[model samples]
Target: MPTAISASVAPQTGAEPRSPGPVSHPAQGKTTEAGGGNPSGIYSAILSRNFPIIGVKEKTFEQLHKKCLEKKVLYLDPEFPPDETSLFYSQKFPIQFVWKRPPEICENPRFIIGGANRTDICQGDLGDCWFLAAIACLTLNERLLFRVIPHDQSFTENYAGIFHFQFWRYGDWVDVVIDDCLPTYNNQLVFTKSNHRNEFWSALLEKAYAKLHGSYEALKGGNTTEAMEDFTGGVTEFFEIKDAPRDMYKIMRKAIERGSLMGCSIDTIVPVQYETRMACGLVRGHAYSVTGLEEALFKGEKVKLVRLRNPWGQVEWNGSWSDGWKDWSFVDKDERARLQHQVTEDGEFWMSYEDFIFHFTKLEICNLTADALESDKLQTWTVSVNEGRWVRGCSAGGCRNFPDTFWTNPQYRLKLLEEDDDPDDSEVICSFLVALMQKNRRKDRKLGANLFTIGFAIYEVPKEMHGNKQHLQKDFFLYNASKARSKTYINMREVSQRFRLPPSEYVIVPSTYEPHQEGEFILRVFSEKRNLSEEAENTISVDRPVPQPGNTNWESEEQQQFRNIFKQIAGDEMEICADELKNVLNTLVKKDQDLKMQGFTLESCRSMIALMDTDGSGRLNLQEFHHLWKKIKAWQKIFKCYDTNHSGTINSYEMRNAVNDAGFHLNSQLYDIITMRYADKHMNIDFDSFICCFVRLEGMFRAFHAFDKDGDGVIKLNVLEWLQLTMYA
Candidate 1:
């Protein structure tokens, strides 16, 4: 018997749950729950807020699709404004939204003209070759294709301006609803189109997918496997043909037999003279779908063959074994008939297995997973996908290249419970496809960021490690991450790597190429055997019990002097408003020769008062003053911790430690400026100067952190540029 595990684990939690065990939602089709204690390890992030379902309608395809038909209108997500949501899409791209029924667009439009086939698809003006290629592969397997595009409704039956498509998002399969109102320019299709004038299923499917991703611009460019996986809840593995396994042909053949959608691409290099097709008749940098694989007997000898179709519906490879090639004449008349050899202008053509291996640079195979619960005859895979963010000073640790911060990024605990029988190897092993893809980079391209160089590292916990120790430690990754169970450090939008490991617990960390480069990512784990996944829920103990301000023993002599200064400004009332705070600042800057306020406006005084006004009384009492002073004292302690000297001053070198200790991780340029601002005659920062500097520094840090809207360590370049020009100037 195989070990069974649930696909969706509970969301991450802060404290340990009352019952330290898996909470099962059996109706969700999860078979087994994770054995749980306290969430001391990766279980911490099981319930993180990163994942957001579009809505909780929980409707079947019949119910949702019928709802649109009843309304006699196309489906429009009330939550998202059709025109203003995505910058690259509806807004900047200038889409003329029009929802017309099949008959409205064409004199006699059909949902699908004849039966759907690879030849039906044609590339339009959009740069979505990857998606069209996947659609072509879908045509080969009607069962899988119909599964994605439900077969219930047609143009004649439910003639509403609405359509729906299903996609596997992260851990769940979701139905995306969209209106038939597509972007058109002067009554012509702007993006993907079909070869048949009356056909609309291919175009409608593209619109539904665009709506699912927030906009049409989002579907501009992507790898085939992403779309193929969405079309079929299949496990996809990509291979660079040059580095493929020894039994690559055998693997491709077996995959084709088991109903796999495959795609391949030539090296993306096009000569300037050849805009579309090269001299060899193959389109440069274009994706082609692998429609069929065959082993035929030619001239009494066995020969392997591959059938490929270009999404453009023209410009095919004019090589050996191509249409009307000399190789076809070697076949007997009966053999040619058996091979179903029909030569036409359609993009599809047959090529020898050898020629295919030589021409294509990359291959992707998406295996249609079998349902293990329904039948024990086939192997069922357990899949878990989690969404995470790489926030700077928090989770934005880079790859193992930056050892100091790399381990600080998110880590998932993968508990492989069972191993498969391997006849070639002595050890029972489990196979895992660790797939990582960064999200939203394509959407942010107009904003000056592209797909970040991304990858993941997987470390196996030693057999002897027990309990919480099963999580890989930071030091363990310092030198030998290369020794990890699986790690692919590369610069690509998505990367999939396979590994065979003995049944054990392991930690997987996905990160970008450089530290602090921020992006959202989805990490998917597919295992041949059932496995459990959880994230470490790390809670920072920042809110420690506060000491009473009345306790004089806690106050140093300098703190007492500061309190006296406050009392003098407040005139024995021991309370100060924004006006009094301004007066106090003016008096102090006048009295202290070292202090300077270059642009200290009344707004600064009000901002400081707002920061310390815990009770929001528009004023700060003695207790509030003490509370605020203690925070300043905390910053002083951090400065002194790095000072390491009783000289009452520290040099520029120590400022880095002070800033980091204070939890404000500024870049090198900002750190230098802040450090130099407070420097004394010898470029040393005195205790008095440190207090003034950090008080303002705290405000600046809080403001800078606000610009990180996604909580990703990265700030928008335009925003940063605006800040640099306005704030300092």
Candidate 2:
């Protein structure tokens, strides 16, 4: 009965989203699913050229470790250098820090002492308690803990200065490598630390995380859900404890039983910052993990109790339910042992469920299912992840507000193969959640870039458009209504919504609410049942190439003009070099004031010359020149028809038809590549670009036919011939 909220919802009224964290897989009997099979799935990416790494080469642990072992030297990470820059970005330095290894802090250093537990993590001077809480929760599930911290690693073996940790970044798991140099002040760990002085896993893990997000200062403060997702890759749902349903305790019991990661915290409202440290021994803004739930026998009655652990070691809740409170004297030893009640200030304590809701303002539960709407569903979700980009004018077709380019956004096909199985069997629908996340805004701190307003719209695919591999175009979107969409568009890192609809094929268009904002994005769709995913299907079949010479005919006067230009540019033998061809086309293109442009580039003319340079003279002759002139005239007419406003550049929407008009057949795939290549960031195709694209295509097609001896694609090209083809193309 809790008001379930996705990560997208903005903070308001009773509750707001904290950062999400990863959940443990249900495979270890920690969390059980209705079906034993691993139902979660990931969609392969297309057009996933990620943010450039710039100059630094990527490093891997296996390779770096082997190299260090061979050389018998400590591995120093060149990327995240140990310097003050790695400690602070813009925040004022709170202390002069010294960097040290675990051995320097304690003689008998340990990667992990005995076993990992909530007691292992303790907050340092840095305000990253949220991360500490997640680490505490991570210890409860070994399956998830081993993933974030590879268990194979140790201090005794492979004792290199290098270490690595895995974090779920966007839709993929990335291994962040770092050096073992821990920042210290007065010889103590400066950020997140371990309770055992000699223990170093948590400290090194924090360094890897900081390196992943740019610097340690960047990890100053965040929500538990964020760390939970990074650690467990789980779907997180948040609840305002104040607005929680009557069965909130039941929900928690079920979630934890099913391997869901749990974390909570007292409200961190800025206005009440001074009151954060309460008299009852709870920090107002501190984050804590829900490690266990039990019913304590008090006054011969069962009172719901939740076990909480503070990220700061040695802090205990001191209310009536506090350790050694006189009320515990009444409970028998067996019942007390069953509840695991310990009398110590080990940062772990029990608070009555009533007192829990009164003090803890919020709770976050991350699952391995599409339980965004109904968080307690006992199901395994099938997830599909795809990476995409929204280049201005190209793929950044804004929301439906800009109908002209809306279809230009990346399209994904969602095929609901079957409906969810229901005992009642009254309704037939597929339940899925679509989450669209724009990447890298958090790292652009220097540029001051904020999250863009992004969302996705789902439209039922028409019967005819079901199986084609073409992208849906402007016309299709203009005529069809979106079957479902994000609940609302908001400027958050991620915006997601849950939907239950009739089982059918649908097209999901993910885009920024405003057009022309350039950025990379990842799209994720989680379904309770199998959902087949692919790039959006085409709105229609490809139109055949336009007939040669098109429908336009040249008049006697036009032919005379063409001959006059060719003869002047060439000679009696009718030979003209690329420079001459450039001049001739520039002159011809300027003839019509309505079709006026800056004129074709010399490079473009060279391409046109090469297209018909059969003898490889790198020049055009009378016959070839005549053939090219006729084609140019016909193509110019097509451009004029599509450039309705005579803007000299046609909108991307008109590109396909214009290409077809110019006698080049194009399917949706090629058309998509063309737009990404030739169209400017604004998505406009000028005459020069239009001509150049086709010229290259024609040249490549011709080259393929000539080299493909038997008409099959297989070819044996010598180095020189391959160079010639590549250079010319």
Candidate 3:
């Protein structure tokens, strides 16, 4: 459940008041509620009012209910224990109780039980007579019966609970709990008002009918017909009886004992004795259980006893033992054909156990149980499990988990070394190493011991300059480590092995050693451990000292030209808009001019740009351009002079002239400019360079073109003199 809640605390001073901020509360199904007056608040109010019982909003309830009402039937297979005899007996009983009379006259009427209604009871067409009979028995115990039926709440995670069902099979009872609900009329496990009641009922009946035969339509017709349909697994018909034989109760008991219903036909011998006068005639009748045969003392005396009814219920037997029977007066009927009741030739009759078995097509015992068992027809079973221990190691080859092959594996061993105290410097080294490892992993490669041979250097300075110092350190490591690691992997094995120093060796150096420049520290990696070999004796120092005045300012004309060219190419490719182009060119041109004045050549600029293009794409994208630009920004204000005509970009001609003025040959100047400018294979300038060049050239062209008024590309002496005076003024 997702819910939102606010985390803000009330202000202590009680100054006027601040607006409530968003609050996030977990649970309640990711629901968010706003304070006072927000969309969520309003929704919450509406939900609280309309669907109080559901715990969810009215809209949500509506949606869920709508889904439940759709036509769908859920079939479940429950595993019934093989030992459940009592349940088996209970399942033998008939599902329908047929009465000769309508429901109103019956002393006790059968009603739907467990599920929502009789119409909802669906029997999967399996030969599980026991399960079906159990279902019928459960109907007698409605509430207790329903308790075993799984409900929707049972499926919910937090509020779920198990329910048990018991069934009597043979003589004993068996019980089982199921996880899900019995399907409703709509075939869903839940009920809703919108479901079609008639359809549900029809579906249930169809289910039962299908179990008897292959189809449900065959079971339709009359009461006895329906009962017989179920009994013989076919369709059947039933008739009403006005009266029955005197021994109905005895016959009923006997039939119950014998475990089957009896069938017969009836006929009237004489109809005058009937209390309710009506036509009496021969008719077929069915009965169950025979009490005793009435043996008269006299040889010719009429014999009569008792018989019971199996209501698929009817009024009574309309033959010899019927209420209108004249035979009570001892009248003789040699004409057995005239009897009120006639035995159906193939109709059922009570018989001794032996005869019952011989005559009836089928017989089954009905057993009742105190509990019911799960009726799911499907069952699932489980199979197997296994377990153990493992050890792991690291090496250039790869890490491996070992079970049997352990000690001899060099790949799994760890190497350790002691180093002098330099906590900050060590931290920097460790961080750099971690970063390198990450890069290796990203490339789906192993961080081999040899790869660690690459050298690293960390420098520290005063806290006041920490930010700048850290930036420089990061930039240097990122640029150099990437190249060096690749080189180490491809070249020196011994150097790589020695480079695999432990993280602790990179410890920060103490400020005490260099107290005046307190907090200053530096970390350096050796190609080999000290005192290891002759070559290892040589120490190469790459110092990242605090920037000071005397170091060679690498920002020379060549370097500046290289950087400017890369910047133009990178910026153009980046497609930076007009205003940005102006700023970038202004900055780069100014730096280039300054570097030129300082005697830096175009070669130096080219070298710097080459260093910056990490991917070796020969051109810099915006990120690389900006990085290179920052490095040269401090050297000169070349941007001002580059925008000669007061526009933003320097065109080829303008660029050539600018470099020439700075003492660069045309070819060298062009080389610097083109190399710095990002372009496609066709050599077309990119958007960033184009905009910058366009603006810068526009200005330069305006100044120069104005002087060459004749449009001959040359400025006469008079024009130059006039232009100088006007520009000066």
Candidate 4:
């Protein structure tokens, strides 16, 4: 299998939060019309590179639900693993395959056990506690659960022994279909299970997700936010408990009120070691879902409380506010009734705010931007996403310490129109989130590439520095660490930093942690206002003259003779290679007086060869060679313009003027770097050095132009291509 490398950069924090416009749903069936030709559509959100807008659509659960009913067959995925070991299940646990609907399994099996409550999910043998925790948190909202697992699905109504579930993969919703076949040991589920034996939603949902990724093994270990995003088409921001925002408590309260799903995990990561119950009653390295947050009066004093669930359906925290702890005794019956307090071994437990913070090390909150409730619909934030890549020899110039070519990588220019409308605040604020994610690492963990350290730099583009400036000046980031507005540089799979910036145009440069490392990335930009659009650089294309057509009447006798000689030496071929061109040059040098006087040597002939081979094939066809011949003639004019003394070389002081005349813009530092690399021992640029410098400049020019797909002289990337990564496959 070919190894794949990819990444995503999403800048999310921005100006004052504003109410977004009404969300639009794509017209069904016509895949091309989804998102309405707008790449920034919210539900159909996928900005991509290379793929067309129509490529994002997939069969909806409703569509597949109807199809399975008509076909009268269970949805047996052709690629489903044949047996247990095929999906890497442990040999000690022999799994017996069973294909049956809910009625056959039990007297009254439910598609959704107990109204999609958190207690309905119970983790079994699988190590996918992170995913189960996400599901538990997702159960908090009935509207949200119905949106994820369509209400139309049930064993009796649409029972063909097939079920379909929808997940937001990258920028679009994808339907995954699976049969009711499950792994059973001793006639019971061997993996994820629910409290009631008749409840099978958790098992079936897990199976659908497993099939979506490749197998159950592929879903073994991962972050909860990844699963939450898939279930809710939400934007997630991860926070470390130690460095959480000052307003974190308020953020958590608002998140729960907004129906956002959250999960937390302890610090330790001991592989394959499962502790049925820790000494503190909180399992280390195990993920727990946050179900509720509230502040209420208890015994004439106000106390903050948080509710959490351990997917195992049994373990409870032994500290204060725990299930049977003494803290509950202090609360009177009325207050207990008001808070809906309960003490049970159903895995759900309450903890004080202080204890919650101290015990959990990391938290993941999925913002649920796409599927926000109708009440919060107007509060949705519009997101603009851009996708990019870092090829080793091309854009992967890496970090800034490599001064020479760091500026050559792709750069995005974002224009912030307005600051947050905070009436009392004197400081202007711009909030945006920057998420840098490595692609395909999760899917091909065993056989494919691993994650790489990645981050991005944001620089302010002064108002005067508008139009035609493709990149920041060489010294723009050199003077101080404060030059770039971003708070700090972090290397992680996906770092979503929310930043505030006064109204200004900013440049974002995404890169690998080290210099010259290659990977592909997607950069997403979100703000309160829709004023954000990439600034396109207008570059002047080189206009080298083409050779006059043959058989023209207005040709001098000498010119006609030379043209005839050129055709005769070239024969049937349209152009010539280096060796063939050398032969032609040799013939011209012997016959032409001007060539003899100029003293052009074989080194010059080789420089010309290096100049014309654009495809790097070391061969030039007719059109390529003609462009080279005309460009060489043009360079001779530039050489004479700078070499006023009529010497064979131009002075070092005059090289910049000569290059600029040839249409290449080099900053002072790049100018110094290039001259040092190519200048002779005498520090003088001979005709050879001059042509070589021009060739290098031309290559840069072409590299920048390659990204301007529509000939609009600007770089635009698709956001969907970056988010999907390997998730789409």
Candidate 5:
């Protein structure tokens, strides 16, 4: 059994700072100058819709297949180490960290530890990145990591330890693996020099390209447009930033705190102090986080701390918002320089939180969880078979019983039966019963009832040998609460041959079977007074063939041909016979002189009736007759096959021969009885019975088929009367 973890954390309410009111900034009119062409229109539309897209290039199926053959590994940066200890070591190594937008943080961390207890690969795709990251984070947890991977030899013998990364490619998620390390400075694997020595980085890039667009060439010179496609499922809509706000870090932090991934901008008319420098120009960029804002300040004075991350990670505001712009000339040069601390190019910046909310699009969150439980509060009953099998016709004492009700604790009852045995053959017929009871305080009185019932039966069988010698053996019967009124009988005869069975402890343990319906029935097993539902009667027939194979009586060629012809006439119908066709084909065959005349000839009648016999018995059952006559118009071959003997006219001899060929071997008395029973005033038996009788191999089958007058295939009322008057009478 596996456990599901909740994805989101509950909101914290104690001592959290209140949200700030909206404020207007002075630098609101500046246009973005970083990118040559302005995409403000597209950006505005995207902001209004609030749909995030992962811009990645599409690749042909053929190319993707080719790339799958190449093996690659993604080198992960040390900053995101396997565990807390590794994290400390990686950071101490002075590795440049590959940072992303702050709003992307989630409560459920991914990542687990690897050891004898746990070792397996996990995947992350679509909006489940948070869950995947959580899994990755969990790798640091002790034995908790091994829970996901089953500990078995199946995993050790094969390359089963691989985890896959799926991103929407073309139309569905394409699998990709972590291949190589990102760029690194010093011993770190992030923000290294462009000329850094690393074939692994190139390999990773190649693998990424292969996963995205199928070829390294396609990935070679593509700009951010192509990269976005490869990353996200759709294209990116760039936007221009006019006069952006200062304090972007605060804005980024605030967005993250609010669980939002949006950014903002401001067009200011006057110079505003941002960080330690004054900014007063058109600025354009994406917002990442929001920190804080000064509220209820003087009407003329206002400031906010906002943080932003550039997807590219290198660009910054160079105008009035730049670290050392002249708008802050009122401050000393050295002091201004101090305020202009270097903002890492890694897609992070500071701006007004308000502006950040207005400019960037927020990605949607999608997480799901499901839960299931087993109950102990159920009601049940035991079903006992005394003299015969569950089906009607079988040897005596081959009884099978089960609980008549559904049981919540069905497994417990089954266990008890599996353990019990008996010595005396007569007393071996008894076993144990168990019931699981649970308290339910529901309004309904019955709702608080017991849950399940299980029982076990002990029985014996006799074995006879040469010289009239006989021995008695003992066995057990088991029943469960899950399946009502069902008990499995184990014969002592079978047990003796399989294992030594003589004497053992015998205990009538109590059991319970849960009821499927609401009702009451007689209680047979447990002595406890409880309302037990009656078990539904299920008629199960078991077909037992003799152990010997290839013992069926052989049929002659003529018989085979007759059987084939009969089947062809029946086609797809069920219970086809003269009794079935009486209302339809009977009237038609009677009214149409041509049909009667044709039928008068044995060959023609056989041709028409042969198609009605489906089972190759040379006889047409009611079902087969009904189906054949219904579609007689569609049967073009019927007339040809039934018209045997090639004579122009059919006589009594031909009719008798056709019947004989079809496998009917009745004596004159039986034939006359059947004929008179199914014949009309014209002295001709109806086509339904005519065809039905041909395939009937035994006298009993013929009698049974004749007794069913309504042509439903089953004998109904008056069956005995009809048989007495038509045959023995």
Candidate 6:
């Protein structure tokens, strides 16, 4: 027979609220081209280490560069070499496409012409305007700009043909290094380049980014938030301009004041409208960074204004309040001078807030810290970010809709101790934002690995159960509905939601919307105050302590009673078959009201007999029954321990630990099979099912090892061998 296997809470206080959708969080698909193992032989399932980016150990640009200089050779990245594969994953390589160092394209090259500035970036031949938009905002803050683009190293000083950049990946900042080779056509940069001909920092930065994402073609189009997060390790808020809040201008002010990076765009309604030049001078579907914001007196009224820069480095806005617009006449001359209003056509321009909202379709605010949303300057957030995985059979329990398997998903505990800081709001709720970001989906685009439909749900733990430090099981979810969840599960790189949940103990369950879909993810929760959180687990490892019998332990004359029962159960032959065992077990089950069982099924007895029937007799002899009785007793205790409420079903996820506790190693594949075979509609197993599963698994492993003579985990079973194996198991 075949086997099968199976799965972020947010905080809130009672009432649920909804934010306007679509218009608020509209995302663009192509804005610009720019962006097992084994059963452990126990401890052998995985290499317990954080391997460097893309399986290549990070090479130090300094060490490699110094070595290159000393050896009188140019530095060339061995990992991401200047090759066609690195330049384009799907497109055919252009014949004249050549890779050249900065010096090859110019007589004298400089890392930065003067200093890293927004103007340093000019859209080249790639469709990664979204990435360029983010880069423009990155240049506005020296601290953040330098963090991504290091200040040291120039083209002529000890230049080793190498440069390094830092990007936030998962939960850590990864230092990505690359050689100075730039993809070019006829000695000219092919992608993002600087306005200055001899300057190459922007070009080099683009190359490094392309390397990070696998190829330049993978950077074709994406949301601005994606690049903003990669560059700053910040969380972003999406606001659909047409549906924006009345106080959106104020929110932008606070976000900028808190050192957040911002970008906005006019999205294309149709494919043909992409990059369409509007009469107002703003290009539809083009990425733009919000570089400045201010309020000025116009016609005796305070007019909100926003300044934005098109990454194209040209096409200044041509509307009221734009560069050299007639609207400037409405404001006092002294006020214009104080605000330092300028009329330069450098792709940067200002417009009234009303016009800004009407012109731009979407706004993105990437906050360096959660405090960017706080009105109180002293208030801050307690942020907890966890790296987790949804491994098939072991942890990839689908969504709650699949009640039988959802509990198998990864579980996390989040405790909010304080409420949101709001004097006017009456609800005693904790305001927090939870973002679940899938890892490596973008980098895997070349391999056709798309984003998994990922989302999280939050369930408030009952106060009575909070004292038990164990992973909530399927039974828990079967009884308690999720209080809050993401707007909806979507196949996006990240899904996030802000919630004002009641302060309490909650379990955050993150999963791919489907069973057995495997992937890695980052789950982050930001609370108004310190949050207590960790991965929730009820798994009892073989190395960890298990509940012991008080006073008398097993094997202490208790064996005598067990042996007597086995003898009585086995007839004159001093043995018992599956029928006999079922009769005995059913009799006992009916006699005990506390057991809460409908009696053991025939399948359970058969599995029990198979486990200990060493001789091919299809039954358990006295000695075999003795061994089976001991296991039954021990397993009975384990089931009772998990089914604390004693309605007689244990959490489905506990099966792996239970098998391990019984001294049988379980790899994820085998676990998957067991769950498919035994786990019920509730994603849990009863006492009978548990015993049957463990016994059958034990018997199968034994028979498997017998046939697997070479022990390479492979076996060639003839008809006779197959009969011998399947007949009992």
lDDT of 5 by residue, 153-242 (tens): 121132211222334333233444332322222343332111122212222322333333332212211112222222322221122233
Q: Order the candidates by lDDT, highest first — what do you get?
A: 6, 2, 1, 4, 5, 3
TM of each candidate vs. truth: 0.69, 0.81, 0.17, 0.69, 0.24, 0.72
Tell me the tens digit of each residue's lDDT in model 3 across 413-507.
11123332456564422112111111111011112111111111222223354222111222222233221121111110011111234332221
Report how far residue 425 has shifted in candidate 2, in Å.
Answer: 3.9
Candidate 4: tens digits of C-alpha lDDT, residues 149-191: 6555677676766666667666566666676777765577767
Model 2 misplaced stretches (Cα beyond 4 Å): 1-72, 91-95, 156-158, 170-174, 238-248, 265-286, 314-334, 343-346, 352-362, 369-379, 440-450, 537-556, 651-684, 708-718
Cα RMSD for candidate 3?
35.5
Clash counts for all predictions: 11, 19, 123, 28, 153, 27
Clashes of 5: 153
TM-score, predicted candidate 2 vs. hidden true structure: 0.81
* lDDT, model 2: 0.71
| Candidate with more favorable, higher lDDT: 1 or 2 | 2
Model 1, global lDDT: 0.62
List model 6 lDDT by residue over 1-729, tens digit each: 111111010001000011222321334211111110112222221122232443235545566777889999887787798888887776785476888988889989988866788877888878787788888877765555666676666888888887877787877777778888887887888888888899887888888888888888777766667887888777876677778899999998886677678888775544466677899898876678887788898888888888788887788788888878876877898988876678776677778889988887778787775422223563456789987877665688878778877887877888988887789989988888888999987788778776676788998999998855566666788888888887667565777778888889898898887777878899999776778877776332223237776744345665655556666878578878888888766765565565667778888898787778788788777677666766777777777777778888876677766776677654444566777778886567888888887777667767777777887877798898789678867
Number of the top-ranking candidate, with lDDT as the measure: 6
User: Once model 3 is optimally superposed onto the true structure by TM-score, how far is the C-alpha of residue 119 displaced, in angstroms?
Assistant: 16
Tens digit of per-residue lDDT, candidate 2, span 1-729:
001122221121112223331211010001111111111321112112132232137645777788899999987778788788788777667667888877777787888777666777777777677777788777766556766676656778878877777777786677777778888888888777777888888889888888887777666545576677777666666566778889999999987777678887665535345225778887765667788888777778888888887777666789877786778878878888887778877788888888888887768786754322123445778988877887665567788888877887788888988798877768887888887877876566436555676778899988887776567777888788888987556555666667899988898898887787878888888887889887653342223355666434445886778678978878776899988988888877687788968888988988898898888898888778877876787778888888888888998756866766665665445666788889986678999998888788777777877897896667789999999997876
Whole-model lDDT values for every prediction: 0.62, 0.71, 0.26, 0.61, 0.27, 0.72
Whichever of 2 and 6 has more TM-score, that candidate is 2
State the weakest 10-residue window (summed lDDT) of model 4: 25-34
Worst 10 residues of 2 by lDDT: 24-33
lDDT of 1 by residue, 56-166 (tens): 255544565678778766655553344445314334544555434456667767777666777667777766777778888776665556555654446777666556666
